[model samples]
Structures are given as structure tokens and as C-alpha cells.
Target: MRNNWLIAACCIALPMATGAIAAYVTIQNVQFWYPVLRKPIFTPPNAVFAPVWTILYVLMGISLYLVLREPPSPKRRLALVLFGIQLFFNFWWSILFFRFHSIGIALLDIILLWLFIILMIRQFYRLSNKAANLQWPYLAWVSFASVLNFSIWYLN
Candidate 1:
């Protein structure tokens, strides 16, 4: 149905829109704020971040959409709330790392973010396996990002 398609589109748009807003915030500080940092040895090239985040954001949107398509229940509602909380952490990491230029705080924030992602994934699994599966890439990325954040904080 057209309505179903529209709902799906909107669900997908939510995370993508959040990512876009986060990216906008990050870019504002990256050039002047980021360049001076003492990056870790394994830090990926600057160009790698945008494409990787774009794909991850799309996947995140798809995962949320899958969860939203299911019938509403208390468990489902709780899962949605968890998803939103993790997203807040996700969005703020950029602000902590880039805008405020606080690497140590960013590292701590990202560890919390990684834990939230795991909780979100488990919650998603209870509602929809596909949704939970879709979040694995995000979990993996955030896990990696957590280590990177720690390394940056430690090295710098």
C-alpha cells in the first residue's frame, strides 16, 4: 500500500536526517578543530569517514524501520525508546569529539554509546530478528570507533 511505503520512507528518513544533522555539526569543526589533533596511528584517512558513516546511517535507518513495522507492544515500545537513547549518544559523540574537542570525554561517551548499541541490538532482536541483524554493522562500527576514540585520547 502507498501508506505502508510512505511509513517506511519516513522511518528510514529519521536516522538519515539525524546523521545529516550530526554530520553538519561535525563538518563545522573538522577542518579547523580536527586538523590539529594528534591522531592515532591507525586513524583512517579523513575521506573514509563520510562514506562509511553514510552507509552505516542508511543501515541504521533500515533497522529502525524494520522494528517500527511490527505491531506495537510494551516490549516494542521499550525497544524504540532504547533506540532513541542510543541515537542521542551517537549524535552527541560528534559534538563531544569535534565541536568541544574533548577527546577523553568523547572516549568515555563512545564507550557508553557502544554499550547502548548492544542494548539496542538485543532489544531489536526481541522484536524482530532482521532488525537486530541489521544493527550488527552499526555495533561493529561503534565498537571499532570506541577503540579509536580511546586510542586518540590516549595517544594525544
Candidate 2:
């Protein structure tokens, strides 16, 4: 039981930590570079991003924890692998868009990220439906983000 709790803690911490690192990379660019870009009119206020991302990260952590708690199986392994892959793309999207200012490339990365999220959710469903359902908001947000990303690239 203690081991399960510890694993849960680690699961939550890992994604939150990843978000923190990505946020660090994003802050300066968001302040200095992002303001100057020609964004789509639908863009949310800058103030909205942090809180939204924080919540999403927490949800993602919980989703991961639920999946990780499932019995060991090839399906579980695949789900875990998909989660890690999507997280990698999620982290790097900040660097690609904000730090490097490669908006087009960032759009590509985000599309891939979105696909991986779908794959992850599908696999998670096999193990835990709640875990899979938790990812829907994340997917919805990323779907919006993908449009936002493409718009940013197009307009700018």
C-alpha cells in the first residue's frame, strides 16, 4: 500500500516537474517575444495559460498514476511508453515555439503531440476507463492549441 502511494506521488510529481521546466523555458519568450507576434483574434489572454496548464498537468499526472497502478501487462507497457512519448513532445513544443521561435516546426510538433495523446488515451482506456477519461480535457486543450499554433504560424 505504501509502495502504491509512493508510486502515485512520483507519478504526479514527474509531470508537474516537467511542466515547471517547460514553464521556465517559456517565461522569457512569453514576456518578450510572444507579445510581438501577430496572433489569431481567438487567442486567450496571456494570464490564462499558466493556470490552465497547471490544472492540465495535474490531471495528466493523475491519469498516469491510474494507469501505472494497473497490473503489469503488455498493454500497460504500451500505454506507459505512449505517455512518455507525448510528454516529450509536450515539453519540447515550448522550446520549439518560444525559445527557438520556430513556429511552423512547433506546429508540427504539436500535431504529433496531439496524435500521441490520442494513442495514449486509447491504451489507457484498456487498463482504466477513468484514467482514459481524464485525458479528454487535455486532448481538447491540445486540439485548441493545435489550431492556435497553426494560426500563429500562419498569421505571423
Candidate 3:
């Protein structure tokens, strides 16, 4: 039981830690550089992003924990690989958009991120429905974000 709890904690921490690192990169530009961009009118207030992402990361972590708890197999390995790839894209989006101020590149990164998310969801579903369901909100948010990213690129 303790081992399970420990594993769960580690699972939850992984994405949360990734978010923290991405947030560090984002903070570098969010105040000064980001304000100058011609964001889409539909863009949420800056205040909305933190909380939404926080929730999404937690959900992602829980989903990960669920998957990790499943028996080890080729499917499990593939799911883990998919999760890692999507996460890498997710982290880099912040760096591309905020740190480097490359909106066009970030848009491309986000489109890839969105696709990887769908693939991850499909793989997760094969293992656990609850795990896959948890990813829906993340996907939804990223979908909205993809449009927002494209709009920002187009406007600027």
C-alpha cells in the first residue's frame, strides 16, 4: 500500500514538475513580451491560464498513475512512450512561444502537441477508460489553445 502511494505521488509530481519548469520559461516573457503580441480576442484573461493548467496537469498525473498501475506489457510500454513524447512537445511549446518568441513555430509545436495528445488518449483507452477520460479536458484546452496560437501568429 505504501509502495502504491509512493508511486502515485511520483506520478502526480512528474507533470506538476514539468509545469513548474515550463512556467519558469513562460514567466520570462509573459509579462513583457507576451503583452505586446496581438492575441486573439477570445484569449482568456492571463489569470485564467495558471489555474486551468494546474488542473490539467493534476489530471494528467492521475491518468499517468492509473496507467502505471496496470500490468507491464507491450501496450503499457507504448502508452508510456506516447505520454513522454506528448509531454516533451508540451514543455517545448512554452519555450518556443514565450522564451524564444517564435509564435509561428509554437503554433506548429502546438498542432503536434494536439495530435500527440489524441494518440496518447487512444493508447490510454486501450489500458484504462478512466485514464483516457482524464485526458479529455487537457485535449479540449489544447484544442482551444491551438486556435489561439494560430490566431496570434496570423495577427502578428
Candidate 4:
């Protein structure tokens, strides 16, 4: 009983800390981010991004719980590590593109991040079908973001 709550507590912590780190990265570069050459039409409203990201973060937390619930194995451990790397790249891209305004490096970072995510999805799927299923939405979002990033890089 106690262990379940402990696991849940850890699950909650991961995304929250990631989000907090992402927020700090944003706060340090708001003005710069606002001026970036974002693509038209599909670009979401400022208000929309916050809510959407919030939902995704919650989903991420639950997905982590799913992965953690499974039996231990080297494969699961590797998947988790890959997931962490993708997340690190994910968190850093915002800072690079927005805070530093390095479009070229950001583009490269996003590409690598996308690859890592796809790999993570594959590994996660192996651990638990549901765990892999949960990452599909995240994969879709990143697919869209990659196009967006390419468009911005091209535009600039």
C-alpha cells in the first residue's frame, strides 16, 4: 500500500520538475521567444499552449506510472534512460531556440530529440503495450513540432 503511493509521488515529481525547469527556461527568454519567426495558421495561441502542455504533462506522469508498474528488466531500464535523454534534449531545445535564439542548433537538437523519442516509443512498447500506446500522442505532437521547427528555421 505504501509503496504504491510512493511510486505515485515519484511519478508526479518527474513531470512537475520537468515543467518547472521548462518554465524557468521560458521565463528567461519570453521576449526573445515572442519575436521568433513562427509559422502561420497552425501556430497556437499563447493561452492555448499552457493548457495543452499541462494536459500533456499529466499524461506524461501517468505514462511514467504505467512504465514503472511493469516488472524490472534491462530493457525497461534502457527505455527509461532513453526517455530521460529525450526529455533532456526536449527541455534544452526551448532554451536554445528561445533563450539563445540559435535556430540552427535548435533544428539539429530537435531532429536528434525526435529520433530519441521514436526510439523510446519502440522500447516502451516492448515493456508494456499500454506504456507504448501512451507515448503516441507525444510522438504526434513532436512530429508536428518538427515540421514547425523546420518551417521557422527556413523562414528565418
**C-alpha TM-scores of all predictions:** 0.95, 0.97, 0.98, 0.89
Across 9-121, the per-residue lDDT of candidate 4 in tens digits comes to 78867876886787787775665565556665677666766676676666667777788888898988988898789888878887887778887898899899889989988
Candidate 2: tens digits of C-alpha lDDT, residues 36-150: 9999989999999889988989899999999988989999999999999999999999999999999999999999999999999999999999999999999999999999999
Local accuracy of candidate 1 as per-residue lDDT tens digits, 14-98: 8788888987888868888777777788888889888988888888888888888889999899899999989899989998999
Task: Estimate the Cα RMSD of every predicted model relative to the unseen true structure.
Answer: 1.1, 0.9, 0.7, 1.8
Candidate 3 lDDT tens digits, 41-129: 89999999999999999999999999999999999999999999999999999999999999999999999999999999999999999
Q: How close is candidate 2 to the true structure, as a TM-score?
A: 0.97
Span of ten consecutive residues with least summed lDDT in model 4:
28-37
The deviation in Å at residue 72 for candidate 4 is 1.5
- Point out the worst 10-residue segment of candidate 1 by lDDT: 33-42
Model 1 spans > 4 angstroms off? none
Spell out the clash pairs found in candidate 1. Answer: none
State model 2's lDDT: 0.94
In terms of TM-score, how similar is model 3 to the real structure?
A: 0.98
Error of 2 at 15 (Å): 1.0
Clash pairs, candidate 4, are none
